[model samples]
Target chain A: MGTIGDLGEFALIATLTRRLPQGPAVLLGPGDDAAVIGAPDGRVVATTDVLVEGRHFRRDWSGPYDIGRKAAAQNLADVVAMGARPTALLVGFAAPPATDVEWAERLYDGLAHECRAAGASVAGGDVVAAPEVTLAVTALGDLGGAPPLTRAGARPGDAVAVRGRLGFAAAGLALLAAGRDGPAELTEAHRRPRPPYAAGAEARAAGATALLDVSDGLVQDLGHIAAASGVRVDVESAAVPVPAVLGPDGLRHALTGGEDHAFAGTFPAGAVLPPSWTRIGTVTEGTGVRVDGREPPPGAWDHFPT
Target chain B: MGTIGDLGEFALIATLTRRLPQGPAVLLGPGDDAAVIGAPDGRVVATTDVLVEGRHFRRDWSGPYDIGRKAAAQNLADVVAMGARPTALLVGFAAPPATDVEWAERLYDGLAHECRAAGASVAGGDVVAAPEVTLAVTALGDLGGAPPLTRAGARPGDAVAVRGRLGFAAAGLALLAAGRDGPAELTEAHRRPRPPYAAGAEARAAGATALLDVSDGLVQDLGHIAAASGVRVDVESAAVPVPAVLGPDGLRHALTGGEDHAFAGTFPAGAVLPPSWTRIGTVTEGTGVRVDGREPPPGAWDHFPT
Candidate 1:
């Protein structure tokens, strides 16, 4: 197996980007100074996220492809949360000089596949040598002339709703941590988050006030909307969809588990939600997030401890 | 004065983004799921560059602010090389958990200031924990309805021209290596590159066929245009400007030094070049780069050695 050092920078880049099909919006693709992507709406939604080795994923637990997919999913979810259709993704990758070229190419494959799922493409990126593997993915989207659905737009009387998986990724993490990897689906969820990308526009069209991707657990992520909008969020435990596989502690995972990439939003109190949206709680005239009229579990995905 | 661990992620983020001014093209800024930037030309030019801590710069040599500025200059130069006007910048910063919060903020300050120099702004980004400090900067630009000026547009018999300093950064590296850092301008050039951002649109308007930023030396970078255009570039040493401060090895430094962020382009045989552009070479029907009819001295700044 050829290491990155053996292939050199340019050849490895060429190999990694070989036959990378450009998406419809990509006016120009890789191997250029910069990529030109069409933004027909006259506006582009941009978001960036960094995934580091060990802190974000374990190499033994997740394949490079899975890591790449997770990296793409997180940023795409952010763009979608802004009520935009993803256009292209720019990646900045860093790894040790000894990294295997095949591993890096597999990671690029994962990034490209995830972009395809979002109707986007891996437009362009930069690769450099560092101490550990790190992927910094920047996602760009077109807003389709719709005003962005920001977290600050949630009103006190809004009804909180969610679409897509909530606690599956966290459950998967639990299994992986305990060295029990039987549930393929659960473990897969941890490896690759499937964000409800389409639900963003649907919720926005349905007059959703505020929208966000549930990355750091449902309740913890909801706290962002609460803090940004100066409103209180009360997530009822019974209303949260905790799958049977999670057992008795499923509620805790659903409430505080992260990396699900589910779509969470607040609609008008009496508004009918789009398909697959489960009503979870209500926005009220207060501050902070609560579960069953009490404080939520203290778990959070902080980059650093307080 | 606190470490990142002491402040936590959210608080540090709030502090970093607080009061950050939005650029003219920003429809939505930081503190949201994604920043909405105006792509008035119906297209956005995007590029990403990663700067690793030890590989790109040593903390003892360059301050955090200088590192930030260097990162911004590199990506912005990429966008400009596409013949686009820079619009916005997104940064993905990864630092150790024990990193000083003040240092991180200063680095951000440097990023914001450099963006301002290019008439752009830091719209949004993400900060995460890592084993080392790394900055992943993504720059976006507007084409103003003009067709992109790619490297492949250069034809045989085109005139090769350059604008901005050629060997100052490399000279600075020499000074730093020899422990003589008195030449403030040269050393500063290495710490923070000042690319001729306006030269991009200027060259396009002047009917330049091909263009690129001299990130990896004049001969090396022009080799990109030569390879892409399937032509040979013969640089005239007499016409090339090598400043005296570069000393006896100025010509070699100008020819092979990297990271000057100078602008290089090819124009029609008799095209009137823009102001400040120095005619340095000619394109011919051949392969590879040459200096006065001889093969140029071989040197390169490769990320990974072959």
Candidate 2:
């Protein structure tokens, strides 16, 4: 919607979640005051992310529809990062009262498009008046009888691997920030990240020891694994698979850029890597993340940087 | 915190959820990238709400602490209104980088205070930078072996009752807007609502057929019950146990004021009303709501007013 004030809260929500298909996992959907989601596994993995108007995305760079898709994609990626299949999403939207209802409809369409792509549904949500548009998305996932692959599972001799494109979104963001025109694919990738949803399950099934989503660059996210697992990780720059379009800058961007939402994991020394995964590093007996046998500078995107 | 920008996103979250106790139902709490919550009943009741800075609360009028408590309270109240016990809360906070960390800590303190009061814990949350402060809270509740008392279950011959104070918040809001000094309790009630948490479970235990939380005005909320159940509800103003401090004007406030977060329900005709509940109306074989045998006016608060 152009602005949320005009459409009002209830009407916008009604328009947005109207046509979405409800899965069997969702006993109740958006119409009621709350939603009921089934958790047959007796445990549910949940995470929430809030995307703001100017801070998270700008209207000049991305349309309201793209914003909706990006919000759902990032949150769903979090669940996938945990090696869980995303089941449902609950969204909360806040915007001004002077916004158009049509924009909300388009935004919902984009949200549903991404959710369906990931084999999930928008279970329910709430809408409220606000100064600027803010989207809060909570993603729920099913563990599917598999033990959760936490960051603490990695051990020395584990091979580090990654699935999906790295540095694409960050490079695309740089392109957008510099006001330089780029190919439609590059811009589209930056606006809407298509994370590998199936790779998460594959990694877990392939005996992944530790796992995480690369939303805050490779080296930075690896630091999390290092800290949690208390083991050092060494990255082989030559082995890193950089996207064709990124060329030389690809390595640097992949190492330090953020928001790619790619899956990263560590497997046993002799474990056969999944077809979708590319080996990039290995775990060592120590602490922190090292690039090319040296400690890399701490560089990662921080939303609330001091 | 003064401004969130200065505190940084991670630190802000750490400060906010630090004191939160781990509840019996929570297998994990804040700290991990994602939280795992136990769903012992095999089902989880989920609800979400987003509160914007300028639209939902004015910084000038409310401290960061109050805002945090108010945000958590409203969402948890929804779970209680559904005849469930709140188990966990996941929050998403977006704010400017220039904000103070101490203010963010105080806000978290408020959130933790409310969660403790309601016997729940902050499971996890995400913090991001934004142009203004915004909070998105999602509450997960346990049904406690009782079937949900949905709005569609009310039938003719059901007794209508409420289990908490009404109009205090609305009256407080009106007084605040008018700059008329009133009792500190009235003003505080508007800023921070005290919902009847235990009463919800009790209502379900007492065989409440249809139930709703009085987030909106009593007459207006009753209309929703009427429409959902396809039954008419007649409320006797004289029977409403309004606070004596509200006086005659208080009666009008109780009828039309919103945001009390009280539990209202319909029960079988011979069912004994619980000690916490007071009978105020009865269900009839018709549609819509009537006050004192006359059709109630349509001037109640509408979140998405046309």
Candidate 3:
């Protein structure tokens, strides 16, 4: 396959954008200095995330497609956590010119796949040369007139609930670090997370008082909710749902391993819970996260770990 | 000042977001998962650009403030080229953990300064650790109920016009590449471009048929308009404005140097040109860009330069 340098910049963009499907939200896609996307509700919910090659993902350990999918999944999860439906994604991709063009195509393929899965489209993007591969993803969403479910809305006596799977990615990371063989499914979850795309609206409709995307481990993410809401979040270790695939360390992974992308929220006591969600804890007047009224261990994913 | 690692991700973000002005367009600012910005017109015009450390800008050549200003200026220009007024900006910055927090704070100051000059606000952003410094900027604009002026709208018999200074950045770059000391003014222009942000609406209101931001040299950008509109763009070399600083090579810089970020557009024949715009060329029945009835030199900025 020819390298990106051989194909040139504009030609490479043409190759990457040619086959991607454009959704109704995108009024203008590519071929221009800017893109126009519909914001039917007269407002836009925006979020951005950047994934660097070595710091965020190892090219040797994950395929381009998986990396692309994971990048899109994480950004989309941010919009969903705010109780909005993602409308479009704008990607900024940078890589060495010597890299094969096929790699870029596969990476974009993964991005397209994830966007399609989320009912969103890749509206526009920028491609450039850099010393290391990187992806900067920005997601735009529509609220459909509902107030955004922020992390500060939870109150004392609220019930904390979670929707979707957790812990598989952490366990998969353990296996990868140890060079131990693990189930294909566990490793796959680590490579490409499957966040419940529709669960955010479900939680909002059920009157979620506070919400978060479980990207930095359940306890760590909930700690943000606790700190922001000035409420103590106490979880029952047994109530925390850990995938059976992680074996005995499932609970540990559930508590500290990041990138599960599950929906976690707090609702008014006695409010009906969505079928996808399970009550895991209770909110009380205090500060910070707790496990059975005790302090939890000190392990959560930090971008710049001390 | 402490390094970004010592400050940590959350603290770093807090320091960067603190005191930055949030305009009325931003319903929600940082410290949350995402930001909510008013779209007003039920549609949004969006664009993103990534600036890598070595490829886009050199840390040694430009101060953090200048870098930040340049980044925001280029992105804001993209939105203005589409005849939309920029409303908000979301920035994603990545750098080595050892980077100074003061550096990040200054970069954001530059971003805020430029955004305010363009009548926009900093809505939300992400900061992460990377091996090299990189910036990914996404700009959102509102059409205010006006139909978007696209590059494909130009027709034969249209007059091509350009607003703002041209070739200064290119000449500035030439001075820098040769290690020759040029006038401080010329070098500053290369460091930071001042695009005429308000002129986009003025051109649109004056019946501009096609519009473009001349980011990649006049000939190169106008080529895009010609290709999209299926018409020939013939520039009059004598009519093209060249900055006086480049001495005898002013016309060369005007024709081939990039990053001027001047606004170029096509208007119907006999249409009164906006006072802000100066006539530079004419559109005719044909394809491709020509200067003074001949093909211009084959030099324009490309990310993956061969």
Candidate 4:
């Protein structure tokens, strides 16, 4: 098979979803007009993200498989960020006429790989011809009898914490942008993000007041927590953990760069932080996020950066 | 702001989702790590479609608003085809760095327009910078006491029927491709598809045996039904109602042209077809689709035409 135009939309989708594992949760799968997933809890947590070629990733920097992995990972992370267990994923892929079937298969392999890692599966998707490679992934999750942790739940006197690596993806991105091929760790981070999925569940179980995934810069994302929770968040710069492998600039990269996919949460005062997580800041009686008792620079990952 | 690169991802999404009406099903809307929607029925119907610039629509031929409407229409149509009531839509948009913010807003306006038409709402989505404009929309729906209508339910004695216009969109596409400024009706069909939302519910209520949307040509989609349902579908060209507004070649366009987004279904013999739906064919023993007792031409809307 060659380009999507040649394979056509239905055939392309059939080829892509052929090998995916089917589970009971999928009442209806790919060959259908729509996919039916078991929500069970009377509520489904859904989120969508789009990745465009060139802007999101370069074919030269990442292979088709990497792109698929990144697309699934990011969307699945969104479900996890809601303190839900990802159950299914629906993907939409648009690619040019000259694209190869092998490339698409590789991309699906990556998607399947990540979904398996997240204990979910690729349920269904649509394939269409486009001028560039674009991926839209929607993740559906089950809340597992727990109320969703929202940004508005944090209160004053809450202890702020983080789970998983911070700024490693950003460091990897910087390395890639600078054309510096250094360590395998950095390259892997950029190619496939390993978000702290378990931490989201852990935080929910721990009675976290507010929870969020650090996809944007830490300071900026904290500001969202502050704004939504109606409390000020103060991060102690020195206390914020940085990966040893990232060197001195790692902290800054983690704090400012986006796409780390780490989990950040607030717990009631005197609550014991999980051993897997590190204390980064605290919730206080105020509004907005502050770093070391001062306002950090505005606009960390604003889409319309001014 | 010029281009998605200029505004960045976060800011662009913030601007687009701001002030948009979030339906009751959206328990947690945008601004969080992920969105939480009220599934209510313990199952969620999900589908995704991606539209790329140039391949899906030429910017010169379609305004940003038209593109947005088309994108939302196609995905929501899938949910409806499965006998689900569309509840929420998640959009992912990718555009070049120099694109104007106003252009993005216009696209959202178009998306909102279609969502409103379906009695659905745009819940949340992502904005990313890319070299070309790309849209990925995922639609969520409620089945509401009805089992999903899949392609595998057709029986040998079932009657084939269709709701909504056929071939008009394809006729419009042909006119556009030929550079013929035809009637406004044809042009509107190509730019914005109007799928029969209520008809999907009605079909489910009326006990449709098999169902699908006419997106990739009637003959081809019917073939899918035939293959999936283990039955032969014979479509009578004369019975397949062609919209009169499509002019002389309307029947041909309707037969082979795609993107109508009309609901095509199979009902048991003597079953009452829903209002506005016309009988087009009948399900028979065997497999594959035939037109007027003969094998139809193979290349009609085949994405990978031989």
Candidate 5:
């Protein structure tokens, strides 16, 4: 296929939108100036995230497909963290005119695939020319009439739990930085996160009090919940799962590395959790995050680390 | 006075979001992973647009405030074109780390101001680092139980009407290009378009058959309605208003220049129109648009013009 410049904006949009499989939530899909989505519960949970070329993702390391999948996964995970079911996404893509049309198509395919996995659809999007590849995705979700599980809902006696592997993406990042080849799975995890999307709703159904997606490190992200709820959270490092691929520093990665996209929440003490969720710690009357007993090192990922 | 790099991401976010004025439509505002907006009508109209530095707006030409106002206005107009009341906006902004924090703050203030003008709120947003300043705004609106006024609704003999200025922004652009300083009003109009947001709902109330925001040139954009509705639209060139600053090229700009954000629609012949709407054209049994008696040149704005 020729470059996007040769195809022009309208033709490229036509080719990209032609076969997008929209779900029931999209009342009107991509052709119009705006999309109409059925928000059956009278409320829509919306969130947006932007990924820039060099800052968020390196094209040299991740393919267009991988980048797209990662972008969708991150935003979908955010909606899920609000205890909502993702219904649709609006993508704003900006790239140089000379960029390959095939690359753009593959990127969109990855977005469609990931949205399908979440039972959502690519409802609409805008495309524009920029100096670098950039993706700004806005995700919308329905609450299904359930009250959102906010970070402030964590109670002092709540049990902290988590779903999905921790630190696999971070380990993968470490491997990439060191120029070392990982066992294929760890490297793949780094490129595209497989967030347990269903776990958020499941946790809500099981009476989880507070929830958040673990985009930052586990302890670091849980700190947000602790601060919001005005309660203490203690993570039992031994209980935090470490994938074998992370090797000797697996525990460290599990504690402080980011981009795992895991689901973390708190539930009433002794509340039954679905098999996927494992109790990792407890909420108490305090002010911040602690590992077993003491405050953990502030090694979590900071976008603009001081 | 420091750069964004000095403030860091979280600190900057804290300063930016600490006092955002949120309207009642926002059920839950920022600080969470996602924002929840009340969609009382059981559905929502959603649209997104991305503006890149140098591509969409030049920093030297438009202030940060003007760019932000323009960005919010364009997206809000898209939602209005769907015959909905704008409720909230999600902004995803990416800028270089060296960018002045004050500029970012002013841009957000402009966004907040325009959203307030539409009776909407800044629900949530994301911030990231990119090589250039980029903004992706997603607007969400409620339809208030009204069916959307799509492009495919005009019928033969319907009278086409327009609300708001024609080619005003374009005239301003021309003046800016020529370096001939005109009225401050024209220069401001180029920097920030005052889209007739309320006119959309009024047109719907007036039984408009089709509606669209006049972003692209009048003929090019109206041609969309003609193609979708499979009808011919004939504009009375004499009836189209021209701002005096445009001089002789006023007619050309009225037909071919873009970025006006005017509301244009078609109503049944002889139907009573809202006071602000003016009959400018008539729909007939052919396809495409005509100015007076001939097809106008298709010299509309294209992001990647061939």
Candidate 6:
């Protein structure tokens, strides 16, 4: 109804946090000094990511609701990538004093809805004033007593498989950059990546050796697994799935696109994978990543050196 | 040695996270998708806070290192305020690409140092590009099997006590604003308020009826306790401590100053309190807070309406 400044700190906080759904794991929710989340495994998985205006997203292309969903999805994707079940989120929001209270509330609505989708809760957070809008989200998760699926566990003879959509966000981003809209799915993916939330535990149960989410494209992220596991990953381009809607750009997007939030992992070479997982590559005794037995060009998102 | 842009993302991340000391609770530290922190009590306490450039801090007044410590200290204090022992911190830092890589490294050093001071660790974090420096810090904690001390538990006739510092930071800010220095102790307190980390556990063990940290002045924070617990708090002016340097202004500063990170708690009447605590007030059968049975002026920090 009014600007954040008009509503004041206490009132603005009350409005944003009103009607939030706290999950079962949240022993103590918001409006406190801090929140208490149940770590059923006696261990907690935590990760944080910040999205800045203009740099990460443009307000013209994505609304506050989608921005909120994107922020929560990224951090939750990280927890799932670690083979943990999402439990709670703590958000640190900063915006100009002139920001409309309605925008902030809608953002919280998206945040709460996403947390519910992931089976987590919006527990606690802080609000501050800044020149530009910035959302810093921290997601906490439970491991259910299983060992974490670290990137250093893959062996040379492991089969590489991935679960969840690949390259759709990147393609969507390109469409947005070019001022093109419909194929709304791609652009929407850029805003809200549907991370395979259950895929993490499934991989763990299937005895995945090494695991990570594909945030910085398939090749770049898999390179991390290669470096950490001391092995080489060779992806067969033919085996990579590309949606027909993407057309000729599909191959390129599937291979080099970012913001997919897909899980890629290695399992025993002959082991059968969960149906959701698509076999795409193999881990071999070497270093670096290869596309169809050849080195792929350098590409992926970076924070600096533009 | 070079700017963050020159060093790029991976190298800069490596430099910032290198040689970081992780505590026993951290099963996995930086360089992973997420961190695994041991939740000794099977429940995790979490809180998040963000500091914006020029808003929360001034580059000329304090360097990156002190800013890092301040950010970590505030979030850690929130966890401790909930009667939990901090376990890990997840930092989301965004800075301009032109920022000095060494500056970022120094900032991380202070974060690590402060975490170690509080028996916690820098488990994991993220770095991104932004127009201005924004550091969002999230602290995770464990209860050690004790019940949390909430603000809603106080009852009339309970004795109130406070541990740690008060007013020094506010006084330091006044001096800084006047372009004065020396009284280095007070100025140092402004840069990094020493939170009584152990006092929270001490209060918990001693059966605190209600508890909270004074981040927004003594009266303002106590008002939260009063409102939530549905009781009045009458602070005895004579019992409040005043440093020698503060002179006549000491009493006013101690009552209205903010950022001391001190803890205030209520105990059953005549209950033995920890040695460090100073009995300052009493919970009363009424509404609102009063100083010597009179209302004090309105004063406290807020994010908006500036």
- What overall lDDT goes with each candidate model? 0.90, 0.82, 0.90, 0.84, 0.90, 0.88
DockQ of 2: 0.69
> How high is the DockQ of candidate 5?
0.76
Interface RMSDs of all predictions? 1.2, 1.7, 1.0, 2.4, 1.3, 1.1
In model 2, the runs with Cα more than 4 Å from the true position are A1-4, B1-3
List native contact recovery per candidate, as a fraction of 1.
0.89, 0.73, 0.83, 0.81, 0.76, 0.89
Instruction: List model 3 lDDT by residue over A193-243, tens digit each.
Output: 999999888998899999889988999999999988888999998898876
Whose TM-score is higher: candidate 2's or candidate 3's? 3
TM-score of chain B of 1: 0.97
Off by over 4 Å in 4: A1-8, A297-299, A302-306, B1-8, B303-306
**Winner by DockQ between candidate 5 and candidate 2:** 5
lDDT, residue A189, candidate 2: 74
Residue-level lDDT of model 6, residues A1-306, one tens digit each, is 879878888888888888478889999988778999999899999999998999888889989999988889888989998999999999999998899999998899889988888899899898888999999999999999889998899898899999999889988999999889859889899988888898898898888998899888988999999998889999998998898877578888888888879989999987889999999989999999999999897667775553
Model 3, global lDDT: 0.90
TM-scores for every predicted model: 0.98, 0.96, 0.99, 0.95, 0.98, 0.98
Clashes of each: 0, 23, 0, 16, 0, 0
User: Residue A257: error of model 5 in Å?
Assistant: 2.0
Better of 1 and 3 by DockQ: 3
* lDDT of each residue in A1-306, candidate 1, tens digit only: 779978888988899898367889999998889999999999899999999999899999999999999999999999999999999999998988789988998899999999999999999998888888999999999988888999998998899999999788989899999999848878899999999788987898789999999887888789999999999999888999988987667888888888989989999988988768999999999999989999986887776553
Please tell me the TM-score of chain B in candidate 4 relative to the true structure's chain B. 0.96
| Model 6 ranges with Cα > 4 A deviation | none
Give the true-structure RMSD of model 1: 1.3
lDDT of 5 by residue, B1-306 (tens): 988878987888887886479999999999888999999999999999999998888898899999989999999999999999999999998888898989999999999999999989899999888789999999999999989888889999999999988887888888888886576667778899999889887898789999999988899889999988999999999888786876778898888877879988999987899888989989999999999979887678887643
Q: Could you give candidate 5's per-residue lDDT for residues A49-116 as a string of tens digits?
A: 99998877888889999998999999999999999999999999898888999999999999999999
Judging by DockQ against the true structure, name the best candidate: 6
The CAPRI-style docking tier of model 5 reads medium
The CAPRI category of model 6 is: high
